[model samples]
Target: MNQESNNDQASAMNTEQVSDQSLSRRLKLALGLSLFAVMAVILLWLSSIKNIQNLEHDLAIKLDTFNEKNMQSLALAKNADTRSAEIAARAEILEEKYTESFDQQAALKALYQELANNREERMLSDVEQLLVIANQQLQLAGNIKPALLALQAADTRLQGFDSQKAVQLRKSINQDIQRLQNLPLADLTSISLKLGNLSQRVDQLALVSDRHPNSAQNKIAPDTSNNPWRKLTQEIWQDIKGMIRIERIDRPELPLLTQEQTFFLRENIKLHLLTARIALLRHDEVTYKSDLAAAQSAISLHFDGRESLTQNTLLEIKALTSNHISTELPDIEQSLRLLNLYKLSFVPALAREPKSKRLP
Candidate 1:
């Protein structure tokens, strides 16, 4: 029994020993697992701290670059603001300058319009004055040439205009000129010149009463070379023939006049011609014809009909009597009336026209 109990007791002790070893091994495994877990946790925490420090350093570098860029951006923004202010000021100045230029242009336009109107008015006034002069020449003085010249000058003045009134005025003036040209007028200067020539030739004219034969040719001189008795006989015969003077007489009576009376007769004839010339210049037809007829009658009665000079003088006087000194003048009232009408109507029409329209 003691041996059996020892065996049982040894078996029980072995079982206890086995259970204690397994428990120790289990404790060691658990401690090793805890230590490994603690090391892994420390490694993970260290790695995470390193990663955090790297991230913080990189973030600080990025922040410095961002601050520098922000400063540059601020400077650029300031410059841009200054430029914007300058541009705004310049824009305001430009707007003011444009407005001033517009005002100046408007003023210039007004001055131009005023000058144009003044020029036109002055021209029209001058035309009116010229037309008045023409009318005076036609009505007061019977001078057709001066009136024609004045009318032509007025037409030349109107040539610058293109209006219908100007054309009508020109047409009227032309009609007046044509009528004046158609008139037959005497040349007073030529007739006066011819009469003056005839008056100067009064001394050369031969009178009928002054007719005489040459007596010196018939008188014989005593010839000294001939015999004295023959010369005495010739002288006696010449004296006898001289006492009985016989002349051929065609007229019944001859007028006996002294030298002073003959001079007075020529002076009277000159007075008649002078009166005729004066009457011609005065444009008196009745006085001119009567004086001319009286001068012709005096020349025919006093002057020798056989003298060429007397016949020519009478012919000239007869031709002068037929000359017309004056003619009927056409009235220039139509042109004057048209010019006045144009002056009255043109002003209102000009006023109605637009300011934008300009003269050529």
Candidate 2:
């Protein structure tokens, strides 16, 4: 019995030992598996940490590059702003210069226009003055030659202009000049010279009472025999012949005048001639003829008609009386009217002309 009990106990113990060994093996295997899983997790954590460090370094470099690019952009933007400001200032200056240039051009154009107008006005004034002189010469002075010259000069002055009114005015002036040229010139200078020569010959004129009978028979022939009785007898006969002169008077009784009376008569004749000369110069035909006739009648009645000098004076007086001193003169009214018309219409014609057609 005892043996059986000990053997049974030993067998149980062996079984318990086997069971303990199996449990320990199972625990050790589970612990080994848990340790291997923990190691793998640690290795994965280490690898993830290294990758995170590399990513941090890359991000820093990228941040620095971005900062540099931002600075360059700011600098470029600043430079662009500066350039825009300068361009704006230059544009303002260019605009001011353009405005000044335009103003200067406008001023120059105005000055040129004013100068042209003044030139035209001056030319018209000169023509008007010439016309006035011509009118005065014709109307007041009665001088055809001077008036004709003045009209010709005015026409020549207007010849430079091409305007229609100027042409018409020139035509009128030329007509006036032609009319004056056709008129007969008076020979006043020749007539006046003849009258002066006649007045100088007045002192030498012989009077009717100045004539004397023949005294040749009263002179005794002075021979070498000196006869006193014959000389006495000849002187007595000469006195008798002188006292009773047989002369046939052709006209009425001659007026016996003293030296003073003869001088006064000659002065009266000269006064008549002087009056005739004044009348001729004054263009008074009636007065000139009447005074000349009076002078001629006085010379014939007071002076000896048979004397050659007296006959010559009478013939000259007759020639002077036949001359016509005064005549109708042509008026310059047509030319003056045309000039006034041109002056009045000048402004309108200038206005109607185109800018391109206006005289420079």
Candidate 3:
């Protein structure tokens, strides 16, 4: 009876464990299916959002690029106009100040001249003073037209002086000239022409401003502009540097010429160049050669046509090689001969002249 009860309990325990395992497997399958569905939905949503983001970013980039291009144009126009206004104002101020100064100086000079010459009593109603004032005003008036002309020229330079976008800038300049014609300034045609030039120049700068890569992000223009005198000075400097490199005048171990000799050569070259410059100015070759020969002698280089010095003296230098000097004191002995020769030559010449009467 005890053995049969133990077997029955063991079978019952095994049946319960099998049933629990079956339930647990079904629950795991259901949870896994739900998780797969949620993950699939999340992946699809992320894909759609990513495409939208890329497109939005692309649109923003393109818009910014377009705005950058437009901004370059705007900045060029605005800057050119602003600079032109500044130049005009400056020129006007300078002309006015210079004219006033000229007027005052002329007045004072006239007063001074009048007082110095004692013309105050000779002139009627101070006509001389009035005349001087008139002359000064006339001179100032003459210069006024030139000053405006210079401004107009600057304007022209501003208009057509495009470094870039020649076509568009020129068209824009034409429009600007048309607009300028409506202003109240005299010499409208000339002023308009100048404005046209300025607009063209702006267009040029804008065109050049576009060439640099990523100019939209970095809008700085190239420094291609040149100044007349400054450019000339640069060219001159470059030329000097090139010449220095070429000549190699300071080279060590230079054969056949010491430092002093080289210095003399350079000095002579400069002197010749100076002489040539003077000759060119005067157009006289004889004068040039004469100056050059003199300069050569100054450098210890002998020149042609040196006069032969003659010694007709009581004493003469006597060398044993050419004269009758047998002693070692030949120099002293020759000097004594020269002294005697000088006395003999002078005495006859002095005797021929009329003698002064003895003082009473």
- Cα RMSD (angstroms) for every candidate in the order listed: 12.2, 16.7, 51.8
Cα lDDT tens digits, model 2, 284-321, are 88999998999899899889887799999999999999
Question: CA lDDT, every prediction?
Answer: 0.79, 0.83, 0.44
Inter-residue clash pairs, candidate 1: none
Worst lDDT run of 10 residues, candidate 3, spans: 312-321
Give the Cα error of residue 166 in candidate 2, in Å: 2.0
lDDT of 3 by residue, 1-360 (tens): 777787778777887788778778777877787788778878878887898888889988988998997899899889989999999999999999999999989999998976844432232123223323333322333222233333233234334323333233334434433433443333323432432332232212121111223324333333366767766666676556545423335634323545575556545545553653344233344644454444333332221112121111101111101221111110112222332342343345657556663323
User: How would you order the candidates by lDDT, starting with the best?
Assistant: 2, 1, 3
TM-score of each: 0.52, 0.54, 0.21
Which residue pairs of candidate 2 clash? none
Task: Report residue 133 deviation for candidate 2 (angstroms).
Answer: 3.3
Cα RMSD (Å) between model 2 and the true structure?
A: 16.7
Off by over 4 Å in 2: 1-123, 212-246, 345-360
Candidate 1 weakest lDDT stretch, 10 residues:
208-217
Model 3 TM-score is 0.21
The TM-score leader among the candidates is 2
- Ten contiguous residues with the weakest lDDT in model 2: 214-223
